[model samples]
Target chain A: MLKIHGIARSRAFRCIWAAEEAGLPYEVVPLGFAPGFKLERPLAINPNNKIPALEDGDLVLFESLAINLHIAAKAGAPLMPTGDDASRVMQWTLWTGTEVEAHVMRWGYNAYIKPEAERIASEAAAGKEALDLRLAVLERELAQRPYLVGNGFTVADLNLACVLYGPWLNGYDLAPFPKVKAWLDTCLTRPAALRARKLREG
Target chain B: MLKIHGIARSRAFRCIWAAEEAGLPYEVVPLGFAPGFKLERPLAINPNNKIPALEDGDLVLFESLAINLHIAAKAGAPLMPTGDDASRVMQWTLWTGTEVEAHVMRWGYNAYIKPEAERIASEAAAGKEALDLRLAVLERELAQRPYLVGNGFTVADLNLACVLYGPWLNGYDLAPFPKVKAWLDTCLTRPAALRARKLREG
Candidate 1:
């Protein structure tokens, strides 16, 4: 059985969601952010000491997006497209990480993660503005098509949806981008995502 | 023929290097950073108006690593590994972007891209420190092997080498991590990278 390290509350949730979507059996190692946890097992797997490290046979891998992509690829077919469509899927996946996720992280850290005294209103506002701009791009694209890549859902949607979950939970307004809002609604409600969300919340 | 838009000096160079490595015939659209350039053709393909967008037949894609991976996959074997090895390749590729490249971008922006008046010495110092820490990871990993994945060069090395190139050019010292320095030297010397570097310098 494949094993995943890290709590679902972290980016590891995406890996769990991917496993569920792929119908692959997986065991969660469940590392937490609690005191003394950082220097423990997670570090042994990932030098970065970040959540969401994966183990399969002799292979140990970190990075939630890579883990998700690997699971999707293993499952094959509709979960991971082929040829030109695969290129588009990769495009959206990378875009979500590089473009969308950074702004979300910025806004989220300021709005929730950072201590009140350290939070800068101006920086948070700028992050929100940047996020809105990126969201507008997604809104335009989603308005034209239901899914990010092909006519059906894939790991691209799963990865992107997980990134957006942060902003949504942080109470970022989704009103300006109705299509993106709808897309998120559709994505988050999927059985796999719902199971992952329950596991994360627990 | 495949088309890659953006100057070789930008992330687009990775796509060019990958195409050269894959032995795929490609054309360069040659975009510049001049004002108003962002609102033009680049936006038509990539809503973010970022360089390094790709067009192959009816498909359009962006994100340098993704483009490189796509090219390598199309080329197959040695350049792109399969199965568990492919997972490790993806892990390293994503790690380069999220961890290594961010610090490089930070230092580069402060050391070169930002105007001297706007540059922050403290932030640049922090970036350098962060970069050193990340490079240590690579140094330790590379000390064990010549390539990032498998026994030979792969897209993982190509992507990572391109990410490191910016910092290397900006005079970031590689002496502290001899293994990483040697690995990078090996990666950058490939004919494809040599061609890409020449195009970028011109």
Candidate 2:
């Protein structure tokens, strides 16, 4: 059996959603985000001490996107597709992490996670501006396609939805990018994503 | 022939390096980084208006790491091992983008890319500190092995080395992490990377 370390409330939700989409049985190690969490057992599997590390027999892997991709590929889920579609899936997944997630995290930390006095207004504003630009790109793209890759939902959607969850939670308005907002709503309502959301909320 | 957009001096270098490593013949579109560059031809392929978008037949892909992985896997290069080794390669590539690259980009922007008058010293310092912590993690891991995954060079090393190039150009000291410094030296010296570097310089 595969074991995933980290709570679903973190980036680990992406992995759990992928697992659910692939119908893979996985056990969660239940790591949290409290202070001093880095010095705990998560370090044993991930040197970065970040959440969503995966252990499969002799192999250990960290990085939530990598873990989700591996699970989707292993299960031959529609979430991954194949060939050129697979490349698009990879493109969106990587893009979500590089171009979007970082900004979302910045906004999240400043707008919600950090103490009121510790939060930097300028940084949070810059994060919001950057995220708006990126979301506009998504808006244009989503206007032409129903999903990120091909016709149906894939791991790319799962990853993007989870990353956007942070911005959504921060109460950032999604109205400007109607397509993106609609697409996100559709993605979040998937049976698998709903189940993952329940687990995360719990 | 495959086409890669953007100048070799940018993130496209990673894709070029991967192609060279895989012995794949490719063409360069020679995009530039200027104020209106984003609204130009790059947007036709990448909605994000980012460089390093790839075109192969009817398929288009963006994200340097994703492009590199597709080329490596397609060409069956030593740059991407098989099975479990491939998973490790994926883990490190994604880790490079999420952990190391972001901090390096932060430092690069504040220290070099931004005008001196606009640069924020505190943010640059924070970036440097974050990079130090991440590099320490790499140093510990590299002390046990010559490469990021498997016994030989892989696309993972190529991706990591390219990301570290920004820090190297910004004159961040690597002496404190001898193992990481040594590993980076080896990866950058590969014939493929050498060719890519030359192209980037031109």
Candidate 3:
């Protein structure tokens, strides 16, 4: 009953993980930003022409994290905890976008997108250092709790996990942060989260 | 009373503008993401040490746009319009973050932060192109409707207007996009918007 339009490898991963975690049945229309008839269709749904545009009944929203949070909130489930802890939960999601995700993009671009001759060794090094520092913050925060939001799992953890795991796919290591490594183990063990990853990876 | 921490030049401008537009009275605390006392405060509201945090009673939140949307929704006197037309309004806000704000950061960094001689002329040119493309999109979208939604001004317009106008401070121009310029003129010139900008820039 919901329509999600985006390619799996793009920002759409956030929404895919979110939908699977929420147990919501939805259709995935694999589309991206490049010019094409299909891309035009998603653009109609999202004027900005961004990925992971969602249509739920009459409601439509874009912005990868916003879509995830919306699904988690509307599902009225534990993927997003409620009450006094709610703001902090939201804080984590925003943290990834503001801090971790920014560095991930820089590092990911350097590792893959930038031409070898054009790559800036210093920028990549700086990005890696910043990423590790961020993970250290996360490591300390996650050490006291099973998930990013405390004893229960939420979209916040899932969002961060996706970013942490992405760099590893390209050969970055997570061994330096024991707590983050363990947190990743706990997050991957979730049936729903794994299911979502399986579908995306497939 | 609500408390918002951050300066007018910061992203906190969005949160403060939303509070004012919603007619919600708030107090502003001078804060910027820099080394100082605010970062040392234990049980600090923001874990990443970023700014533009809001405290209403015990409900604390950060991320300027998120706080804006949250405030708008709760104010029933929302800055967003109603009905199916509302999605278009929503789209504008997302575009602000994805397009206008993004390119602003790009050129802003190059023109202001990036050291001269090291700054790539291509990046600055790309910023010009991005500004043109974004303004053109805004022009086409705004031409069809009086506001981003319909005839009513919403927070969507406010957010985009704030972002679109930033390049002006850096001496960047938007002279070609008459429609966008007119739309900003109407939206930003309003009493509420003027007041909010005054408070933010005051």
Task: Please give the C-alpha DockQ score of model 2.
Answer: 0.76
Model 3: lDDT equals 0.72
Categorize the docking of model 3: acceptable
Q: Residue-wise lDDT of candidate 1 within B40-80, one digit each (tens)?
A: 65378787788888898887888889998889998999899
Candidate 1 segments whose C-alpha is farther than 4 A from its true place: A34-42, A115-118, B34-42, B115-118
Worst 10 residues of 3 chain A by lDDT: A33-42
Poorest 10 consecutive residues by lDDT, candidate 2 chain A: A34-43
Enumerate the candidates' DockQ scores in order: 0.77, 0.76, 0.28
Better DockQ candidate (2, 3): 2
RMSD of 2: 2.7
TM-score of decoy 3: 0.80
lDDT for A42 in candidate 3 is 29
lDDT of 2 by residue, A130-194 (tens): 99999988998898899999989888888788889767656888989999988988988888888
**What TM-score against the true fold does each predicted structure earn?**
0.95, 0.92, 0.80
